[model samples]
Target: MFTRADLGKDERLDLMEFTLVLEHLGLSWTRAETQDRFEKADANLDGFISYAEYRAILEAQGWV
Candidate 1:
């Protein structure tokens, strides 16, 4: 999932890549919901979600 979402292959997911992951998962989230999830995963608010953060979020969602 992390590799798939890291579209840029930068080992991190920017907002666009995150959105793609949600879409790929067929998760229909509102704009606010998506932003909220992104913010939660991006613990450092660095505008990117690292593999660790992505894994953490997936684990929290029971998807890991």
Candidate 2:
């Protein structure tokens, strides 16, 4: 999932790639909702979602 979501193939997900991840999960979050969640998921405040960060988010949301 991370690989697929990392459309840039840079080993991290930008906002656009993260949106693709939500779509892959069949989530229909509003743009604002996604942005909010994305901000929360970016633990390091690095402006991208690392694999560790993504996993943490999934765990927090009980999705993993």
Candidate 3:
């Protein structure tokens, strides 16, 4: 149950945009890895992720 409220104090990005970024990295949205990343990105337990969240993960995981 992902929603915008999960962002907490983090910045915000559209859900589609977040999914797109992951897809571009060859990550399957239906896979556990994607789900894990989504949970991490959601931060405050909300269902959405901000661009900053994506950037943080990209940096941490060296995604690109």
Candidate 4:
């Protein structure tokens, strides 16, 4: 049911939205905790969350 519109203005995945998706998927984590999670997810360290990175985060959160 997910769609491209879930992404942010920059067309990148926003951490807040990502967090919500994780919650909906029955996973839990704090915003502060996700900071490092995001950093690790941003494989290229480009400061923007890529689709691959987002998927990785979800997997790491046990969402998939």
- Which should have the higher TM-score, number 2 or number 3? 2
- Model 2 CA deviation exceeding 4 Å by range: none
Model 2: which ten-residue window has the lowest total lDDT? 1-10
C-alpha local distance difference test of each model: 0.90, 0.94, 0.61, 0.67
Among these predictions, the greatest TM-score belongs to 2
**TM values, all candidates:** 0.90, 0.95, 0.54, 0.61
Model 1: per-residue lDDT, tens digit, 1-64? 7797787999999988999999988999998999999998999889999988988988899996
Q: For residues 1-64, what per-residue lDDT tens digits would candidate 2 score against the true structure?
A: 9998787899999999999999999999999999999999999999999999999989988998
Instruction: List the RMSD of every prediction in angstroms.
Output: 1.0, 0.7, 6.7, 2.9
Worst 10 residues of 4 by lDDT: 1-10
Instruction: Using lDDT as the measure, name the better of candidate 1 and candidate 4.
Output: 1
Rank order by lDDT, top first?
A: 2, 1, 4, 3
Instruction: Give the Å error, residue 56, model 2.
Output: 0.5
Q: Give candidate 4 misplaced runs (Cα > 4 Å).
A: 1-10, 58-64
User: Per-residue CA lDDT of candidate 3, range 1-64, in tens?
Assistant: 1233334434554455566666666667666666667787777666767566666777788865
Local lDDT at 12 for model 2: 98
